[model samples]
Target: MHIRKDLSPGKQSLLTTGSFLIPLFLWTIVSYAPFIWHPDIKLQVSADRSGVTTVFTAGDRVSKEFFPTFSEAIRVENQAIMEAREQNKPIIGSRRDNLKKLRHLAPLAVANGWLEVKEQQNDEKLYGVWKGLAEGSLKSTEVELTEENIEVIRSNWRLLSAYAPTYDSKRYPTEAMLKLIPQGVSSNPVYLPAPHEVIQAGWRDFTTKPDNDMPTMWERYRHSLTIIFWGFTYSCLLGIPLAILCGSLDFFSKLHEPFIDFFRYMPAPTFSVLFVAFLGTSDAPKIMLVFVGTFFQLVLVIANTTRLLEKSLLEAAQTLGANRRQLLKRVIVPGILPNLYNDLRILLGWSWTWLVIAELIGEKTGLTGFIDTQGTRYNFDRVFPVIILIGFTGFFTDRFFHGLRDLLFPWTEEAQTGAKGPITRFILRMSNHSSYADRTKA
Candidate 1:
């Protein structure tokens, strides 16, 4: 007697290793390609005694306008030195430069009440105030002035101040720099609708007007379930019977195969448009689109499975003196059951893709409809979340059907190991215990 093994240890090891390496390879390719191929653009900086401009490779840096220019930057540096002079603190420029003047004057300014420090606008404001005070026009008492008033004075002071002679005065601004100032200074930050605002606006438009309001996330989820339920119900009703007829009879197989194949390739969007025209823009069109989307695929699947059953199993049943009804009940139906379950799982996945087109036809609801509305409004952030939801839901649903398959066909080793839920474990244990008791008695 020979013992049969479906999977050998070596084959199993190979499969396990392949699975691990494939993912690692894919991740490496996806993670590294973008970085290596496309590096971030570098900025070009040009400076003259007048001012300095920074040109970025991409779109303008709008934040630069509020930030000081290079000339203003230098003035800020000079102001720091002058402040040290007022404070009689040692000035530190290059290591070689003497700080004796700043050190000598430091305490005198403090004693005279000329040097003042306060928790002002920021480092920039503090520096501006120090510059003003060092120049002798701004009083140390005015350091407590509001930022708005300080800014007014700072702008006036910048305009009146002469360029420092220490820095070079000649350099032509490049096209990049010429472009950078306007682009940087003029560009405004992109604004997004807040969640509260989005919800309020969506409701205002959706509730009062036609085709304006998009469905909420919950609404889309509910609609998805509804479409899946109805689509499955319709496909099972129409597909299984047609499959039986086509499988059992040669005449029907010849007649139906061509027609089913034709519909299988017909685009869902085209069908959606036609359904909308025929049925008008209502739930009927949406349901019909889902039906058409699922039906042809289910038919092809069931028909193929049924044919295999008839050829291999039905002949044996007929020889055993079984009538058509008995043969169907005992052999044909059970033989097709596993394949039918598998087909339904595939159809469920296809239904989601179809639902997108279905929802596009004046749906005003469901995930696809929500995506459409987001795209129209240019709300890419909102659009991305919906896409992620759809992917996760589809994955979970596929896992569910696979779980169902395992529960129904527990004789297969794949089924037993695939069962993940506690309830499935309980059922398997009870099933095993009963089988063991019968074996012991025998």
Candidate 2:
């Protein structure tokens, strides 16, 4: 199809900007929208009732009596302040201090419906919300009260809980008493988050002083790239020649098909244990995993792509008095060049999918490895950036190959549609110069 080339500069710019910005806008909406869906943040305590914790995840059921009384909140705040002062520090902490300011802001939180409470308490009320938080029925993380929030709480306590009741903690069966705080309450549609959280978490981790010998994000990315580069290189070395032979010779094709097909269907992950056992805990197993994952499929694709060469071109070459060897080299290989390049480009992307799987088998030091470790700790903020990095790396790599292909095969129909970029022009000039020199030598 003839694509329109008459777009104005403004329209072109708009298209270019939209192509990038639209996805980012959509992604942001998806990531932040969950806060709207599950707006209620709740104060939880550890399963053992040692201390208070907070959960940001939405969907916790709040009971009518879930909110702590003004006295209980004050007691918690006093404990925090005492602890901070004992440590020769201010009453503030650096993490999860939203509730620390609660003493001062409790009244505001209650007035704004950020905090909810039931007016009457009864023995049979069965504090479902309180039990859930205390017994670990709900997923919970212990958060520290920030110094700023502590000051906010102490100063604002009177205004915060003006109407809060006095209650006895021992009277309730719940080991932990939890107060519900609304982050946002909406039934509206939204998107989930992992990437944004990952980037944020990763940045935090990067900035924080490391407690151990964990590799940085750049180091992990470098390791992943190293594995993929070598694995893909090895796969091409073994696969391409085999694929060419299979495509050119019927005996080879028939003989290899059964074994190739069987191995391809066997699945790469199944070999994870085997590879580790055989290759040990080094990078060899991971590289081999990538190779196994890409090699057979790549061979099959290339062979099929080679077979799709037009019969007319082969016949024409033969008609021009070309022998079998020359026809195979000068005709079949050349005929399949553009298609083979595209096939390899696509397979290169497929190779990346195996990276995480490969890295999982032996060493856990790459981007995927870090993601796997942090994911268990619910640190998706760290995980998200690595995933995005993988995408960006793949996108730019694909573009690089595409541009390189255009430069190498300017005569192909794919190359003719767009204006040649500087790289293509430069290569074309070099090519012309080399051809001119060859002619002069002859």
Candidate 3:
């Protein structure tokens, strides 16, 4: 007899560590590399200022402006240098020309000035610039050089000239500079939402409040789940029995085949619309939508399973002296059990997909309705989480039925036993030792 050698503890630990690290390394490379390399802009402040000046980033006190269009500002600065050099003397020129040129080149300076003056004065005159820009009153052609504008322009130029070397170097200020800047005078740094904000935004309020009596989030989830569950269940119940009857009886088979074929081609949504016309936008229409969507597929599955079972095993049972009822109970059902289970799984998945459409038009409460509401309100955060939840829930439910098939029909040679049978039994056994032992003994 040969004894199988298990992996040693140290080797196992090393293997597990490697396994975990490999994926982590891959995920880090795949998911985080881009974000690390190039961070996205969460907030943008485009100041219509005079010259290239200090800009504020989140958590940073004063960083140099990095606008692509700031080349015009540099050109103006170069022109100013050339003009001053051409004079060959400290020529005290009118500040208005430089100010106007600066304002044109870097409107961001104007915006920055406006922001600054707005902080000091509670007057409407201070807000006139921003309000004009926002309301589209200040066009590119109209350079309204007011007293307020000149003061803002002069102040911004001074600030930008002081910070010019830092801008050229692409270097941020020290902590000392950040601390020295007064509140509301320093640039306003916009903060993006933290992880907690993102999480909180994902939750939706669906329940009835004092102001409004609408369904809750839990209610919508429960309603959708119920619709999917019952729709598949009732479809299977009705379709499978009828299919079995039709397949077993030749006369019934001839009568039902054409009708089934007709309905299979007829679209469910069309029928749902008709049902809504008849039943109104009540629960009946919603339930009927799910039913119609699932029914045809269920019929096709059940009919095929019945036909196959009958052709293969029904004749065998009959040759072995089995009656009609006996054949159905023993041979027919047993032969078709795996196929039926497969059909059920397919229908369940289909039902989940269709339930969305069912709730979209007719139902008051469901995932589809919730998604629609969120979409109308522009709540993308809530929509994505619900969609993710639906996908994961469907995956787990399909896997569950696959596990169920293996557990109940293990005698079949081709039955799948993927991590579900022995593993599940082992876990259950650990939980209920006496019951497990009795089951094993039996």
Candidate 4:
């Protein structure tokens, strides 16, 4: 088997930068020109609700007055219904008033190009029985417009709300338009908001915006980071020692290999319920989940890395009057340090994956929990930012650790070209200076 050396520094940087920037460019184009895959304009209808649910599109410029009009209309309608009940009068007058307000607002919105009406037969009200197919026949009660069906309908509404905005705008859309007046149709129409709108909603929902009772994004992230750190800590504590033992002793490798492989194949989520049952829905189970995800995998990786150390090096250390302990520490462990650091860096990412599931067990605190809640509410704008935050955080963290590895282990072949780069050297110099200053003060 031929081993490939690291790419030249210039080639590596070019490839890495291109890999990210090219996709980013394409994504931006897709976001602006969403019509390539899906329609540029779509009206999502909530089957249970009446009227136009939401306007979904990119590049729309909605007038500033649209939201105030929508709000005023809703307010007037609610107030009228309340007064009608108090006065023991029919709601016909209130209904007429609501209609009049909408009648006035609709044309203004349409004329301003904020709303577009797509003609539909019977006004796009979906009322067919959707049956599931089983054994080449339609199941009579596959699904219908029951409470369950209502949920399904809502899910469709949410799906559109979430999907459209993701590719709608490279930046954010400012359209605040209303469409398909719901006077005779339904109570609430689902609308695909612009990216900016979603981001603002996410900020409010995930931050300390006074009215928001949920934990801030920072709080959730801190909780998640805490879980990942502790889990990784435990995994490193147990895994490194076990791996060293396994690598040093053939018997230990044979003894634990099958067991490690067995659990490695077992998905981490399978143990979620068991972990919750044992540890309760607190942070303990989540931390355990991360530990389980990282530990066995790390042990195997470290063991393999340690096993690859040169036998001649070990023999030389032994010949130099080193004991078994010194040979293990000074030879085996040090030999694998660079690769081991890289392994831990990669495993830290897995810890994040497990973190998502772990946070779900108890009160939703992390970015994942925020996503779940916002997604259900069809507030996809909020969801996208948190998702982006995760990826963005992971990307930078990976780069930081990658650079740190080169800085710490300059002798490693992989570190040679990467560390010699101007950017890496600058960062390395800053880091070395910081360390030196700290030592001098101490």
Model-by-model lDDT, in order? Answer: 0.56, 0.63, 0.57, 0.61
Over the stretch 1-442, how does candidate 3's per-residue lDDT look in tens digits? 2378656667866886798689657634543344332233322222223333664322223322433334335445445544654676423323343333332323332344543522333223323443344345644332334343344334443433454432332321211110111111122222222323325655434333324676666777887888787777778778888877776677777888778788878778777778889999877777777888888778767777777864756677779999989987887778878888888888888888778888876554677786788777655556755675688789777866766675567675545323334445655566678865765565
Can you give the lDDT of residue 187 in candidate 3?
Answer: 27
What TM value does model 1 have? 0.54
Residue 436 of model 2 has an lDDT of 36
After superposing candidate 1, which stretches have Cα over 4 Å from the reference? 1-214, 310-312, 412-442
TM-score of 3: 0.57
Deviation (Å) of 216 in candidate 1: 2.0
RMSD of 3: 12.8
Question: Model 2, which residues run further than 4 Å from truth?
Answer: 1-13, 30-35, 42-211, 419-442
Q: Model 3, stretches more than 4 Å misplaced?
A: 1-41, 44-200, 203-212, 310-312, 414-423, 426-442
- lDDT for model 2, please: 0.63
Please provide, for model 1 over 222-292, each residue's C-alpha lDDT reduced to its tens digit, 9 standing for 90 to 100: 98779767866887898888887787777888899888898788776686677878898777788887888
List TM-score per model, in order. Answer: 0.54, 0.64, 0.57, 0.63
Decreasing lDDT order of the candidates: 2, 4, 3, 1
lDDT at 353 for candidate 3? 72
lDDT of 4 by residue, 1-442 (tens): 2368767778888998899899767755555454433332221221111255564222232333354354345445445544664686624433223222223322223333333543121111111111111121222221122343243334323322343433232221122112222211111222444445656876775665534576778887777788888989999999999998898889999999779989899988789889988888788988898999999999999899889889999999988999989998889988989988988899988888988887787666677887888788766667777887888888778877877777678688766543354546568567687754543354
Please, what are the lDDT tens digits per residue for candidate 2 over residues 276-329? 999999999999999999999989999898889988888898899999899889
Q: Model 1, residue 8: what's the lDDT?
A: 61
lDDT for position 272 in model 3 = 75
